[model samples]
Target: MDVKQVSVADKARRWIFSVHFCTPIIIIISPRLQILILAFLAASVSACKMNRCYNESELSEAVERKLRSHYHQPPDPLPAADPDSPSSCPVELYQYLAPHEENRRSLSPWRYVLRSMKDHFPSTYSEAECLCSGCILIQDVPGKGRVPVENFSYTSVPIIQSRVFLRRDLCGDGGKYRLTPVSQDVAVGCTCARPMST
Candidate 1:
């Protein structure tokens, strides 16, 4: 066999051995090539580690920051009722009742009643007053049952308005009361009569 051909065969044998041994036989045969391969492997390993390091919290925070930069305020919190109040109504109730004359037609009767009460009545009321008169307007219609507005209890009271608008009645039995009336935009106002202060 030619000497050059013998050299080529020897190189092929080494390459095959390297593959079986799980080593880079071709790169190891040349010092310059080995250095280039090592550099590429190091870069690829670093990239892989970097990609794996990112987590969901980091991604979420990044997205939130981007949103804040675009809009002057952070996203609104989920609607929730007052923590101190008796009612567990979600904050969505207030959002839905917000004064929007154009959207009045879209509101349901219950919503209208709530809006009217918030707009018309005083901020606070005693339990007796609310049960008898405060929530009296919320009658049990054909489909709807008696809408209770008594006490700060969750059972009777459907919604809790802002506490700042409410004051405890000292004259009578001494109970909490809300003064704000429901929104005028609603057609059917609350049926409850105004509480007369002693």
Candidate 2:
């Protein structure tokens, strides 16, 4: 195969451009796949650098940066069923940390993996659901360092339709509890990510 020399700038530009273009295709296919793609993109993008690894702490911080930029809010304290309920799902920033403190290999830039779970408590309860699959990735400008490139991913799991009967105690304990409200839709939004390289 014939090889053509490409400048670093040209290569970086091509990669960033390609990732941006492929995202819509991946998203169009399905949401679950989107999560995976998102993870792949960030990880791959991070790897593109000469030094392709950061520590868990660095990765975690990058995750925060990406999330904060995306949601326009802190990544922690992610939305819960009951915003005020103390028993709500703990605001876990990173569910799974890399085995090593530092990145041995390409880290999962999509480090914020919020798996689906039911938060059941006696007084208050909440839930976080995954809604989609696949993902996206972005690379930094060839030579910039001030911005600290950002990388992250959000995964959405399919929501199964089911009948949910909500009981409300208007009186008191053991008193009349109304189970009139029913729900057939489940909205699950999950995210996973790691960090970005400068």
Candidate 3:
């Protein structure tokens, strides 16, 4: 078996020259000065590591924190209405806003579209319930015997939509998270309307 021996000076020279901070000036400088410069560079590299990017788990936790800060909760349910008697349309306030609003309400899209193609993104979420959960309509079908059938009826129509931005600085200094534009449906008020299809 052949053995290779490396001396302390050789090891020190290899380490010092291997560093990226080494330059032509390093050769002209004194050994003591070179050691000091290398030490400073080592300290700087370690300092940068202190601000290392967040890992998967840490990033998830950070995103959750941002979401919790801007969490939007639905309003309390309205009192139950009489089943047999016709009830007026019910609505409640619903809002989801960012820490700082961008006031880009006009950017919201009316119908479904690709979020990436949207020019304006949501920074604030402000919306309201336009209609009830579900509506059923009874219709009479022509047959030998008159038979009544129930069909799903009403739906909440969006009058306006606001493009809003989700959490920003998701990763911030350490890391970054992709921001996808979101469209929020906004209904100013409630109304009685028929489905275009049904």
Q: Cα lDDT of all candidates, in order?
A: 0.31, 0.33, 0.38
TM-score of each: 0.18, 0.22, 0.24
How do the residues 98-169 of candidate 1 rate in per-residue lDDT, one tens digit apiece?
464312212221222121123212322221102121231234556656542232212222233322221112
lDDT value, residue 68 of candidate 1? 50
lDDT per residue for candidate 3 within 134-193, as digits (tens), equals: 332334556634332223365434455443334333446545444332445544333334
Ten contiguous residues minimizing lDDT sum, candidate 2: 102-111
Residue-level error in angstroms, candidate 3, position 121: 14
How many steric overlaps are in each model, in order? 33, 33, 9
Lowest lDDT 10-residue stretch of candidate 1: 127-136
CA deviation > 4 Å runs, candidate 2: 1-123, 129-136, 144-163, 169-175, 184-186, 191-198
Q: Which stretches of model 1 miss by more than 4 angstroms?
A: 1-17, 20-28, 58-198
Instruction: Order the candidates by TM-score, highest first.
Output: 3, 2, 1
